[model samples]
Target: MATLTSVYADSTIVLGPLATEAQPEAYDLCEKHVNSFTAPRGWQIIRLATDFAPAPPSEDDLLALADAVREASRAPRPAPMPAEHRPRPGGVMPGPVTAPLPPPPEIAEGEVLRRGHLRVLKGDKE
Candidate 1:
């Protein structure tokens, strides 16, 4: 995979490293597409000599990932609300109580084999 930058003023196309963010004027090309690219009339193509290998995770990247994981794992504290809106210490929450869920339907022939939300059925033999 490669990132390409087209210079309209210079009429040149440059192939370089993959960008971390999406650019308004840059394009990310696949290996097959990049290898078989064609420029417009009067346009020149320039390929950088740098290897486009996947970069290893840096210390800062690892530390940032760890911090994010820690933040996400920690339970979120409840935000303070107005006294009138807050529920009583031992009272039930003031909302409609949900009815108990009904049991699932009984399984049959076609339902014997299931694929996700679909059922595979056996066709009648001639």
Candidate 2:
């Protein structure tokens, strides 16, 4: 993609699309619009090299990829659980089910305190 800057004094606009990060001050234009762009009166337009070809992968990129592959190969795969211990298809386990916990006790009228957007209230002692 082309990067458009407004800081130039001659108003020399680079007619191309932005190739990298989208900056707030830069304008990205498509190939069709770039060709049709025209400079205003008293302003000069300088056409810079519009090379959009991606650079070849650097040594660092190749090294990082190799390291990642080596790390992945070294990682231990989880052993499958025994068929006897596996859970049923319907999500039912083979053990005694425990009851859910009771809800917290209600806070007293004056015991509640507020600080900014947060509130502090006394909870059950246990």
Candidate 3:
């Protein structure tokens, strides 16, 4: 079975024959279907064939793990913020800050047909 992983910064995807090894057959398949793959901008064939061992997670991963630990240790809910300290409208509490505006009224049947023709000409409608 084959699984496709993405090619970096490109629309084309790379196919993995198996999770273990990089398959050259996959690249050839993509080049055949994708039009953009020509001589110069030809698809990159990455062969994870050799003894190329993937690098371990870097310092960022370690830091993130530590941060997760610190967060989990703290109580789930923090002290309730005072009402005065909380965000509000006009720098103070008020009614609902925003309201939904009503939608435009339905157009007349004749207007709908005219608009449909215009949309068709503009390639805006299916």
Top TM-score prediction, candidate number = 1
lDDT of candidate 1 at residue 87, scale 0 to 100? 43
Q: Of models 1 and 2, which has the larger lDDT?
A: 1
For model 1, how does the per-residue alpha-carbon lDDT over 12-117 read when each residue is reduced to its tens digit?
Answer: 9999888889998999887777878899989999988456555678999999999999998896978998455434333465665354333344557655555436
Residue 72, candidate 3: Cα error in Å is: 1.2
Best candidate according to lDDT = 1
* Candidates' C-alpha lDDT: 0.76, 0.62, 0.46
Candidate 3 lDDT at 98 equals 49
List candidate 2 stretches off by more than 4 Å. 50-126
Residue 6 in candidate 3 has what lDDT?
55
lDDT of 3: 0.46
TM-score of each: 0.41, 0.34, 0.24
Any residue pairs clashing in model 3, and if so which? none
Candidate with more favorable, higher TM-score: 2 or 3: 2
Candidate 3: regions farther than 4 A off: 1-52, 77-126
Candidate 2 lDDT over 11-92, as tens digits, reads: 6665544546666767866556666778777667665656644357889989999999999999999999855554333355
Which residue ranges in model 1 land beyond 4 Å of their true spot? 50-126
